[model samples]
Target: MPSEAPVQPPPPIKIGGHCFEWGQRSYVMGIVNATPDSFSGDGVLDPAAAADRAARMVEDGADLIDVGAESTRPDHQPLDAAGEWARLAPVLRALREAVSAPISIDTAKAYVAERAFDAGADALNDVHGLRADPALASLLAARELPAVLMHNQRGRPPVGDVIADVRAGLEESLAIAEAAGVRREMLILDPGFGFGIGPQQSLELVRRLGELRCLGRPLLLGSSRKSAIGWALGREQEPPSTRAAGSAATVALAIAAGADIVRVHDVREMADVALVTDAVLHGRRRGDPA
Candidate 1:
């Protein structure tokens, strides 16, 4: 036998020039933090520099680049739509010129999303999962763009276990999308790894990630240099750059458990991790026989 239970690829999502054939192999979404206060310490404030960084990530094996101007770190300062757009415009413009790969704008504001689309962004990644801004879903539906609706528990207390909490949060996001006329095939689900959960819950969330498959959408797991990795290493003070090995471990495990896309800062390493993990679980290579 080739392997154990294999991934059932969801309907392909075509963004820009790429079609994400989910189960063919794990996909990598490289993080391009444009904020000066980004938690990963890889944020580039200059538009030109950020674009160069994003292009390098693509050459290193990124399927998509998620660019964000706001810092999502806990208790980070908030940016209004105008403020956010100001930070994103130049970076997105440069990114459009620098890379042909799909660009995903990681923002929850309808205003920002609209401008981003005009600037050549191919998709939207709402960490609030359509819950923060009522108009965001409408924008997505109207634009007919692909989106990542993540289950975030930043302010609300969890409902139950990690799996249950994530499931419930994502369901509400799905409901919002459906009501807004967004196509189901254009959506992806992300179980927020470090947003509002503790270390144990985060670990358990990944362990049982497959259970969320019942939601009937592709899953995106992003634990790239998140605080949970530092917690897992028992050194909560460890810097983000020092957590690559732990992030790689989570990437491999998540892919085996049915993750379709992995968002990461260490693109080259995690890309290799996803490729090897896919080969192991799927039992095939680029040119290998069945």
Candidate 2:
């Protein structure tokens, strides 16, 4: 007789109007960069084009659509809240008219989040994990909206282990969210790939992602077209569009590692990768020996 496979956890909790079930099936959150300088070269200068791309992503199997105005790429100049809102507001409005998938605002500024939410964003993906603006947690708590708390290490770490560092940062952020009255179930944790981690550190986190799952919050892996992919593929000069296959590979790996949500640029391809990987890793076979 053969041994049984380990049982995966239940799907992610449905927050607001979104269901983020994990393990059962991987969910893809498509990226919609509303800026002209997006590293992925997918940003749409025209609001109509942005809306159309978002609608296409929804039809292409995206479970969510993440919209951002500023480029969070390394060395990119950050935009002010007003500037960011100016670029994002039109896209968000247009998307609301075009697609039904929940909209997530990728921002750190409370002002931007507030405006985006009012414009129909259902969730918040704070890269700074609420550390940049302490008031953002309160805002989320008040709105009862789901927020992804990504572990960021903008400063020097006291320890050398990236996993330990990330765990600590996430715990601290979760504590802050709790203190601010945010619902525990409304929180999601991300390992913060490429935010302040090097290529080796990022890989190690992906390998040890299961440890982060112990935190009990849904784990969101945003390794799509990230700098770490470029480093691993030995294509430092290549753009994000060139990293699609690499990103798809990571999406599959991340799903196997127990990631609840995958933030990705190439939604259609990554969604297919997630489905196939999930079938292999967790789906039941009809005639396999057990």
Candidate 3:
């Protein structure tokens, strides 16, 4: 019989003075939606509420907190830079002062990211993956911050195979980042499960997620309470809040399939899910402790 190949470890990234040793265990990124229309039904309108959410997530074992002002839900009303900054700045300032965990600014605009960094955000998570704002990649490069580049589009046709399509799309994003001077080690790849893709394809991406390890960057999967999970649950008509169990299933499978980070809405529940998944998949079995 052939021997199984060893898993290649993902490079470490430091944010807010904490180092994330990828591949050591799956990390949980808690979501703090500063918008009023978050798909997860957990959005908070006030900075104090967002700050409170961040603090609780950190207490619930979240490795980091993702703070986003604009809602990314399908058909969400787009916000201009000023609007986004207006919603984001206060939350970033208060969260930075309250939570010791690293904060990630989820925005596609470079201007918002710049102000976020000024407000003490530790990293940038761009859903458009440099396709929306040309200045975004350069800004991240200049700041030397870790980046999460997600595959994204609007009404694009499939390339027959979903996983291959995701890879090809992300390749274009990688090129843009590299051309803008962002190093490969500073990049993390997200397959963009819900954005501009159908529900079945999103499930296929989760099922074939291990194939994305070929990209050689730490994979961050954000399938939390997405429409895909609702569809998979045979409850496509259900509200996003009802998809927690479905999200947990996907998170566990993602961890088993080589995902290094899982971004989720229900931080406490997903944190416990990741903990057990890590123990089962990454923990060593030896004699009982002395």
Weakest 10 consecutive residues of candidate 1 by summed lDDT: 1-10
lDDT for each of the candidates? 0.90, 0.83, 0.87
For candidate 2, the TM-score is 0.92
lDDT, model 2, position 98 = 90
lDDT of 1 by residue, 1-290 (tens): 12222346578989886888876778999999999888888888898999899999999999899999999998689999999999899999999999999999999999999999988999999999999899999999999999999999888887678888899999999999999999999999999998898888998778888888888889999998888889989888878999999999999989888888999999999999988997888688744776
What lDDT tens digits, residue by residue, belong to model 3 across residues 3-70? Answer: 11137676788888999887777899999999988888888878888888899999998999999999
The digit string of per-residue lDDT tens for model 2 on 174-258 reads 9999999998888888998887878889887777787777777788899988878999999978887899998887787777787
TM-score versus the correct structure, for each prediction: 0.96, 0.92, 0.95
lDDT of 2 at 29: 87
TM-score of model 3 (CA atoms): 0.95
TM-score: the better of candidates 1 and 3: 1
* Count of backbone collisions within predicted model 1: 0
